[model samples]
Structures are given as C-alpha cells and as structure tokens.
Target: MRMILMGLGVVGRSFLRTLIEKSPELRLKYGLNPTLVAVADSSSAVQDERGLDPKEILDLKVRKGSLSGHAREVGMRGVELIRGVDAEVLIDVTPSNFKTGEPSLSYIKAALNTGKHVITASKGPFALEMPALIEMFQESGLHLLFSGTVGGGVPFVRFVRKCLIGERVLAIKGVLNGTTNYILTRMEAGLSFESALREAPGTGLR
Candidate 1:
C-alpha cells in the first residue's frame, strides 16, 4: 500500500516510526507492503513516486528537527504535496486550530479530489466540515478515517466503525476529555482544580 503523510510533528513522527518498525511484521502477517510514498511538513515536502525510505525520513527529522532537508520533490504546502503525489492514502496530521480548519480541509479536499483515502486527526475538519468531506469521499469512492480525532489512544473510533456496523446507537456518553476529567475528579475529591490541572502533565493527561 502506498501512503503519503501530511505532517511530521510529535504524533505524526511517532506514527511513522512505529509503522516503519512494524513493516516487516505487517508484510508477513497481512501480506501487505506499506510504503510511505511522501511526507509533508510546515517547512518542506518530499515525494518519491516509487516509495520513500522510512529510515531516511527519520534521519532527516532527527537532523533538521523537521522534514526540511529530506530532498523535497514538492513545496511545503499541504496542497502541493497532495496534488503532486500519487499515493493511495493521505495521512493528515497538521496541527489544528479547532476554530478554522484551514490547511487540513485543503489537504483533505486535494487528496479526495485525487482519489486517495484520507486518515486525519484534525477535529475541526470532521466536526464542522464533515458533510462536505463526506460528499466528496462518497463521490470519489474513497474512505476517510479519523480514528485519532475521536479517540487518541482508546478504541472508541474502531469500536464504533467495526462493532457498531448494523447496530443502532441509542446513546453515547462518556468523559471525552481526559485532562478536564482528571482535574474535575481531583476537585471533587478535595484537591483544588488548579493543582490537579497543574499535575495533569505528569500523569500523562496530554
């Protein structure tokens, strides 16, 4: 499977590293050879129609603190990468402002226009721009998966997609924000909300 990633921040980088480390196992287990066809960041973009060396991408990130020096085949902008690459999948991890979807929407649109399945964690795109994106994906017959947007490390998205196939969802209720939940729990337990919030980082709230 050919894939193009849209960002290389902390989460995106970690995802790439994990995928690279797991490729051999994935090939043997699933009879699939997943290739990172391209990568884009705020500073630069790189594309190889055949496939990009994952090790080279990680090395560039380690040396440049970004993907600036990975030998760009296109510019840094998301649209440029989306338009130029011919990958089957597009991974959108650009930082989201939550108010305006901005670059995420553009990148998603471009990929869908080019008939690529999109996997993004940009909440604004799914929350506000979902209708339009859904239409585009349906029209193009491509898939859009936003697992991290709904459940960062949890199984909520996968459960909903897979397990909730033909079942009716009567209701959905749970603590969505872990950070806020931790703080509120501490406040209810006698600790000050401020103190609890301040200690959230150490407890892995983020």
Candidate 2:
C-alpha cells in the first residue's frame, strides 16, 4: 500500500517516524507491504512517484522542522496534494478549523472524490461533517476513518471497535482530553490553574 501524508506538523511527523520504525512488524502482521509515497506541508513537499525514503523524510523533518527543503515536483497549493497524489491512502493531518473547516474539508472532499481511502486526524470532518462525509465515502466506495479524533491516542476507539464488536455501546464517556485530566490533577493536588494550563505542551489543550 502506498501512502501520502498531507501535513508535516508535530503529530504528523511523529506518526510518520513511529510508522517507519515499526513498519516491518506491521507489514508482517497485516501481510501487506506499506510505502510512504509523498510528504506535503503548507509551504513545500517531497514527491517521488516510486516511493519516498522514510528515513530521508524523517531526517528532512528533523533538520528543517517542516517539509520545506524537499524538491517540489508540484507547485500548486498544499491542499491540492491530496487530489494529485497517486497514493492509495491519503493521511490528512491538517489542523482542524472548527469555525469553517475550510482547508480540511476541501482536502478530505477532494481525496474522496479522487477515489483514495482517507484517514484523517482533522476534527472538522469527524466532529461536524461526519454524516455528510460518511455518505460521501459510501457513495465513492472509499473509507473515511477518524480514529484520532475521539480518543486522542487513548486506544478507546480501537477497544470499542474491535473488542466490543457485538456489544451495544449505548453511551461512551471518557476523560478524553489529557490536558483536562492533568489540569484537574494539578488543581486537586494544590496547583494553580495558570500553572496547570502552562504545563500543557506547545499544542495547548489539544
């Protein structure tokens, strides 16, 4: 399977690194070969139709802190990357704009239209446009997966989907936001709200 990563932000870069390190084991378990085809950011991107070197992509991200140094075979806007790439999978890592869902929606819609299965971390598509996106994906015969939205890396979604297959999940609840839990902990443990909020990483409440 070939993949195109549409963002070079902190989470996107980190996920790529993790996948690269564990890809051999993953391939063995899934009985499939996975390849990273393209890496795109707001400013620039690296595209090699054959496949991108995961190590090189990681190194470039480390050195530049974004995908700016790589050669740009396509000069259109970053959003167009999803439409033009030939990869079977498009990973939409663009930051979610809850207000309008501008770029994220545009990218997701374009990828679905182009017949690529999309796995997105963007909140707008899942949180707000889920029903419409579900219909679109079903109509197009593609998948629009948003595993990163609800659990925020807690494995809650996978647990519910895989383990609770037959069980009816009437309602779901969680301390889904790690920042909320941490802040509450600090406050209960006798720390200031300012300090607790400050402790949140560069991504803030996310």
Candidate 3:
C-alpha cells in the first residue's frame, strides 16, 4: 500500500520500526507491502515517490528533532503534507486531545475529502467526530479504520466487529492506559507507582 504517515512521535516511530522489522514476515505471510511515500511530524514533511529508507528515517529522527530535517524539506505541516502526497491511504498516530480535536480531525477529514482511506490511532477525532466521520466514510464508500484507537495493536475493534456481527452487544470495557496500568500493577506488588514507572521499559513518566 502506498501511504502517508501523519505523526513522527514515539508511537509513530515505534510503529515504523516494527513495520520495517516485520515487513519480511508480512510479505511472506499476508502479501502486504507497505511503502511510505511521505511522513510528517509537527514541524515539517518529507516525500519521495520512490519510498523512503527506514534506516535513514530513524537516523534523521535521532539526529534532528523532526522529519523536516530531511534534505528535501517539503515545507508543509500535517494537513498540507496529506494533500501534497500521492498516497492512497493515511496512517494517523498523532497525540489525541479529548477536549478539542483540531489538527488531527482536520487531517482525517481532509484525507477523506481527498478520497484517501484513513487508519487512525488517535482517539480525538474518532471519539469527538465519529458520527460525522462515519457518515462521510459510508457515503463515500471509503474506509475510516480505527483498530489502533483503543488497544494499540490488539485488534479490539476488529474482533468486536467481526466476531459479534449478529450478536446483541451491551457493553465492553477494558484498561486503556498501559502506563497507568503498569504502574498500578507494580504498586499492588509493594512498589510505588512512581518507582514502577521509573523502572518500566521505555516509559516517559519517569
């Protein structure tokens, strides 16, 4: 799939790295080939029709604060980068603001308006504008997938939609914040939440 990625934060970076690591297995097993044509962070955008090098992307992120440090320098923010790319799908893993879903909502709407499929992990747009966004998708016959919205890669949405197709659903509930859960779990085992977060792998709360 030719695609554009809209976020380059920790979650986005981890997704990209995992995609590269599991790509060989993915191609062998599912016949999936995800080529990133463009990527954008908060500051800048970068695009190459031929696809970008994963190593180069990570290296740039490490050396520079954002993807804009790439020599090409597309000079666009999130939504502008969405329009500038020739991608068929957009992956949005930006941070979510439950109060007012500004930029990410706008990004998803613009992508759908341009007839591009969207898969978003950010909770802001989906939670605040689900009715409108779903209506847009249904009317346009396009996809607005949000499997990553609730459980990261747990496929919670897919499981419910596919497994409960004909069943009457009442309610579903589960822990959404892994960090807080981890800290609490450790606290139950006699360590303070802060101590647990400090020792947790890749946790920022420490």
| Candidate 1 lDDT trough over 10 residues, lowest sum | 68-77
Give the CA lDDT, 0 to 100, for residue 18 in model 1. 92
Give per-model CA RMSD.
Answer: 3.5, 2.6, 2.7
| Clash pairs detected, candidate 3 | none
Give a tens-digit lDDT track for model 2, residues 1-206.
88988877867878778888888998889877778777877677778778888788878877977777576445656557767778888888888788877677888888877888988778876667888888989888898788776656566667887999999879866678766887888899999999878876565245
Ranking by lDDT: 3, 1, 2
Shift of residue 161 alpha carbon in model 1, Å: 3.8
Return the candidate ranking by TM-score, descending: 3, 2, 1
Steric collisions counted per model: 0, 0, 0
Per-residue lDDT, model 3, residue 12, is 79
Candidate-wise lDDT, in order: 0.79, 0.78, 0.81
Candidate 3 residue 206 Cα shift, in angstroms, is 13
Candidate 1 lDDT over residue span 81-189, tens digit each? 7877778888888776567787898888898778889988777787668888888788778998877776445658889879999999999888777667778888999
Q: For candidate 1, give the lDDT.
A: 0.79
Best by TM-score: 3
TM-score of each: 0.82, 0.85, 0.87
